[model samples]
Target: MRMPQGKPGRRAAVPPWLRARHPDPVQDDPRICPDQTRGQLGLFPTPPRQFARTHAARISDRTVPGFEAVREELRKMADERQIRARTIWLWRLEGIARLALAARDPDREQVAPQALKDLLYSGPILGQALHRAGLLAPTASHRLVPPRGTGPTRQGGQRDLDLRGQCAHCLAWANDRRVLCAACTSWGYHIRKHGGGEAECNRCRRTLMVSDGMCRMCRIIVAETEVDTARIAMDYGDQLWFARPHAAGLAVGPRTSGTAAARGRFAHKRRLARARAADELQPSEHVLNPAQLELFPAPTRDWSRLNTATPPALTTAAADLVADFFAYMRGRGWNINFFRGSIRTLRILTGHLGADAPIRECDIRALVSTGIHVQGARLINYLRLRGLLEAQPPRDLSVARARRSASTISSPAFAAAVHTFIDVLLGQGSTPSRPRSSKTIENYVATVLDTIETWIAQGLGDPREVTKKHIEDALKPLHGDQARRLHTALRSLFRALKRERLVFRDPARSISLPSNRPVPAGLPSDRVAGLLDRIDDPRERLMVAFVAIYALLPGQLVQLQRTDFDRSKGRLRLRRAGRMDHIVYLDEFTLRLAAAWELHRHHRWPDSSNPHLFVNRNTAVDETGPPISTAAVTLLFQRVGLPAGRLRIDRIVDEAHHSADPLRLIELFGLSTASATGYVLSAHPDRKPGPIAP
Candidate 1:
């Protein structure tokens, strides 16, 4: 090759004639033209592409404002030995310049450093550099006039100076002019200079210093150290922290005095107080804080102040009632911590109704209309208990909820018929030998409400308009218990309505449910032997035996009383509503279980006044003598891994298998004739039904 160019590494220059003929070469086609052979072979060739070279812009000619100022400041910093000549130093200066340009002020010559706060990749380092270059203006006056020096104020020590001083590192206006900024003083300094460095901690022996004597790990343990309060009290020979001396259970220590000893003793006492205050109320006894005992024996000063300091607008009678209600709650051992909401609600009610008038359900209803129904319910209950209520005691909560379902009916006539049926069922206007329970009324209304709404939707608004066709159509989609309940509810509703003359006809009278009851089946042979072994709770074990052995229903089991047990006779009297009471003979196993449960209840809840045979921790404390709920009895079965109803049915069926007599099953388990017959058939499928018991 000939000489390349003037320089060894440079390209050779082209002649003027050659350059004129070829100017600049245009970009070539990326793909090669396909030949016949290539096409047949499915080959497509691509040629290399020519990419234009890009030149990087020079930093000196960057569009950022104040870039020259940044460079000069960096040079000054280097001269002053503030920063070294490193690539990072140049990058930092450029970053400062870019941030300063973006945060530049249009109204003034300099931008406030606060303007640079939120920009991308911006920080105090960039702002500090720009501030040192005189690009940022100080808007905040130095203490409004003369700048404060880096020293303590008269009131506070270093905190005052730190607040007044502007930090050079942060570029804040709070730094003092005479000395370095308090915060920035440590920015470039070693921790050793400030009495902090890696040294072995005294407690943990770790090479990380937190304080003069401890590392961070050891310091946390020291802060959270637990002390023996009883030892401190015994050492001091002062007032007892515990109610009983034995309760403290701490050894005496030598007594000490001095400021440090006083502080340690005070801390121990505070910890003890907090621990005692946090102890929860025991199930058998009330373990209230010592300070809260005053609330039980008598009202505290604050309570007395509230009682006597009634507003002038409130009547004397209303104020007395409010005081009595609070006293009643206090007597019931209610914690006073929950009294704030009730106090506010009662105050609002008594203040508005005026002391001149007695608070009545009508007045409470007016408040309820204004959206305070929860408070109204409380007020109504209080009035009823005080015998101040004139209206009948509020109906069962279930009945109210069931009535709400009837309110959704589109037709007023059908809705009224349903409500009247519910009222009659609850013994509101019509009296029957045995009034239906709230739950029974609720169930009846729930089953028929959907059918009533369906009839309304099908253009039969009146119950009189409901014919056999309507009842049949509604019953088409329902089956099993749902179908049976619907049929029973319809027949009862129309029959009651016809008696009341609300409906002229009874269409559901002839609609019959399946007379055949489902046969009761026993549990598997493998599970029966070990079912009672799994229940460890004395109460649960007793309950399981009642359900699994005696075949007692959950409802009857929950209603059992201590008097009903008849321990002398070894018999349990199950007094269920709507059915004659039945006496169950307890075998030796069940009697022993019952005795153990009674002993457990007596020991666990000795102070309890509840008379129920199976008193739980919750019901034991209640003075109303309400027995443990059916849900509690069901939970006992669940804990044993078998359903209560299934266990009871299994017991009845097993009994039937042994006897195969319907009459014995009925008298033994208090089951109806149909139920007894079903169990008998389930036990022995070839057995015929016995005569129905009258």
Candidate 2:
């Protein structure tokens, strides 16, 4: 019954009972060293020096310099878990040994935690065992806690591997009963796969990780190739649907670029698809109808709404009012999509308010203010538009403050004078024939403000302190149109001040503005040609054409409505603010572009109540919305790398070159006498007027 003990530095002898139990222990288990022995009961084996020396020797030859401690840690893990010696040897050779050799830190005694986890990811049982035995750090184990009813040594663990139920594809929380999140499911397949951490991408010729010789971007492109190619094919089927009338008679030039042509046709198809799917003209199930209320399905659970402690119910009267509002919207030609969104928001709002309470604007604002119902703005709009809520909401004071803060003038007297000057420009007595436009008033105010701010900075406080020298000094730095504008603004400001007795003299009156106009220069012909060729958007193409070909200003462009075009006569009657209407006879190119844009507009918004020729998604929903803003039109021109003003000037100057008659320019473009004469002088320098006879 005694344990076997070997001589110092020598092997232990096998006991008689152990030898009888297994006469060929080494042959039966290769992991059993020949010099080791078991106890009399054949349970725990006796410690032997040869066993440690042999194991250490095997690991020392294979592992890095300082990671010999890993072998001892592995032995401890195997012993604590009662793992079979053969299994321990297999784990060492297969997993742990590889990790030790792969250690990036050569001088550290233990392999890095991340290295261990990465090596043991596929085998959770071994990872947990090593973690329990203290060989692997807690964080080093791939699975720190085994699933219920599973042991550290047992296999086939059925634990959910995802982190917080997140999807493997999108990294977003997966919905119940699905592999991918809702957004990922809706977007279809777009997963990017990266392979081994080394290799060059075949497509982009960049050094990056690749799967099947394709980088992530290249793989994405490949996955989307089918969809893109199909869309392109669809575009090609309808090439001449908006072709110019005279295109057949003209000598053919190079075909439109593939990118440009595909863009235009695809845009048309997309608009058509939207119109078909809008369901505005289709018979819709009006769930808001009182008769259908009994059959309507309950809305699905919204987590945001569930955050409320006690959600209220919709009152009978309030529900009826909301139903009436929906009906009013329907009568006004709003699409079902607007109805669907409004209903969801209204439902949230009604639940936030009590069952007995009527819906009120102040109450809705309170709910939004307290963050209880953030989606109540659209609901408010619906109620207000239906006339059930007539009173308008209070304006945002913060916006008013921000606007006021833009005027940073310091001197009180000078600021008052500037304010008075603005009032005079907007006075009731101003004639309608020469009324100042908002832009012109803004420019006048801006010029006066700048001059006053400069005077204040120079320690002059009163408008009376400004002199002829000050006016001349201000006009010194500015030249061309800027100088003329400054001179005009100063003269007007001083005249108003002198008339009001706020100043003694009008210093700017004697200083005459230079009348020389700068010669107009056109953008490069090649650049213009390239821009026109690349213009793929129907609306933008038309906008640019109006500026480049017909010389329409941005102000005139935004004023155009659907009524301006004369379809039968092929003419566009451009109505000016204060001048006679200038008629443009549409050529084959402009006509086709106009037709395409009209078709696009019709299909994109079949139920749109907007009357403007250019309507976007925002304006299309409202019945009485204004045309596209001046900023939006300017942005359109900017995107095409051409200024609208430059285009207009170039077109005007080009027209003048064809005919030097000022009257012709005036009649054709509705230009004033001075503007027409300036263009004529610029185009035909030989026709310059002789010196005036005294």
Q: State TM-scores per candidate.
A: 0.49, 0.49
For model 2, what is the alpha-carbon lDDT of residue 447?
Answer: 65
Give me the overall lDDT of model 1: 0.61
Under the 3 Å rule for N, CA and C atoms, how many clashes does model 1 have?
5
lDDT tens digits by residue: candidate 1, 1-694: 3666567766567888888998663322212111122112111111122111111112223354566786677666666766655566666556445545533434345655455544335445556667887877786633311232434455545345333433322223444552444433443254567767667555434444345465443332333333333332343242222233332542322433321223655577656755664353122121122233243432211222232222224346556767887886676565546654455556555554433333455645544454421245445655655665534354568889888988988898888888888877766746463468788888898888777766666777677777898889888888887888888888888888987788778888877766665666788988778877787888888888888888778887778888899877999888866678888998999999988998987776665677778877557755446677778777767766788888888888889989989999988888889778888888898666468934
CA lDDT, candidate 1, residue 380: 61
| Residue 653 displacement (Å), model 1 | 1.7
- Give the count of colliding residue pairs in each prediction: 5, 0
TM-score, candidate number 2: 0.49
Worst 10 residues of 2 by lDDT: 39-48
Per-residue lDDT value at 46 in model 1: 16
